[model samples]
Target: MTETTKQPIRVALVDDYDVVLTGLAHMFDRYRDRIVICEIDANAELSDQVDIVLYDSFAQPESDRQELAALVRNPRASRVVVYTWNFQPELVESARTQGTHGYLSKTLPARELVAALEAVHAGERVVSEPPSKRVGSAPGLDWPGRHEGFTERESEILALITQGKSNAEVAALTYLSVNTIKSYIREIYRRIGAASRTQAVLWGVAHGFSPDHHRIDHWLGGP
Candidate 1:
């Protein structure tokens, strides 16, 4: 749906690391008109705070069933989603049994992530795309220095630029306007000390921001 026609979904993000919360908040910035991030906390009292609670397990991917259950029990939020890098089928099933409304992959771009959260808020169960249904490997932008100064959106755009994608292609991938892509690129170049796209690509490759080898299991699911 177009942003103009959609209702803004109230969301609360729960993650242990401050950096993760900050990055997620920044990543969702563009969707402020459609997705309102009402809270960012490690242990927030979500009762009555949001329509959906996104529980991101940045460090430990597995063994969060009890935590998920607790979040589900909270009366503040109507739904809960486990947003993580690990989407093993067993883990997904375990989270479902624990009453999580959704299980999402970390590899999902900002648009898809927002869509999944909206679906959960609508009283639907959402799961990450299984490995076999997925197409060819997407750029694995999860590299070192990700926690550095660059925002999550900047890192994602840089990853696409390093892949030699033009601004239009990057816009399409990110579901953003071309003008927005250009603006972001300008800022990214300034931050990374690059005078041109070639220089940006070089900087990204040198600093380990380039996509790494794709593992079959990784394609199956997870961040």
Candidate 2:
């Protein structure tokens, strides 16, 4: 008797920014044989039935469980995983209590990310090792302000600011110190020629820093 081959895991990427989701989708390009990207959703419903829903926590508030809970309740997704850079204990615990299957770090390499997803699909709850603050982002990821000389971290801070997150709020969401958030804000202001938060918000609004509302199905043609 011959053994049957396993089918590729169907995955849907979810986020509020198209660029963020697009960058994440590209990370799985080399492993198409094992993973199939069904759709990239931005502020939309999960349209396809998928084995996993990889939610990217780009500029979103980590403390809020409303969106995460919605994903967990969706019947179209068999497993929900959070792809985030913030690994604060409370956030991880909240996700777990809300029925999130995996809490993966954004610092995970592409290969490890795929493997973790495999583990989740195999009925195992997975959480990545807590990464050190010095660890850099995984290679080959993109964000809204890369071309404008913003590092991924800086870009994330700017995006949150654009969404009206105060310094304190940003610190709370990213698990960074308030002074550290201010330092990033200063750099963001310098890069964009903005003197005040309002100016920076305007610049961000003009430069794709706001949340998007659409779905990207072109990568694999259609969901």
Q: Lowest lDDT 10-mer window, candidate 1?
A: 214-223
Query: Tens-digit lDDT track for model 2 on 71-182?
Result: 9999999999999888889999999999999999989999999999999999999999999978577888888998888888899899999999899999988889999999
Clashing pairs in 1: 47-76, 48-76, 85-222, 85-223
User: What's the TM-score of every candidate structure?
Assistant: 0.57, 0.95
Best by lDDT: 2
CA lDDT, candidate 2, residue 148: 85
Q: Which portions of model 2 show Cα errors greater than 4 Å?
A: none
Instruction: Report the error of model 1 at residue 198, Å.
Output: 41
Model 1 off-target regions past 4 Å?
1-6, 131-223
Q: Would you list the clashing residue pairs of candidate 2?
A: none
Best by TM-score: 2
Candidate 2: TM-score? 0.95
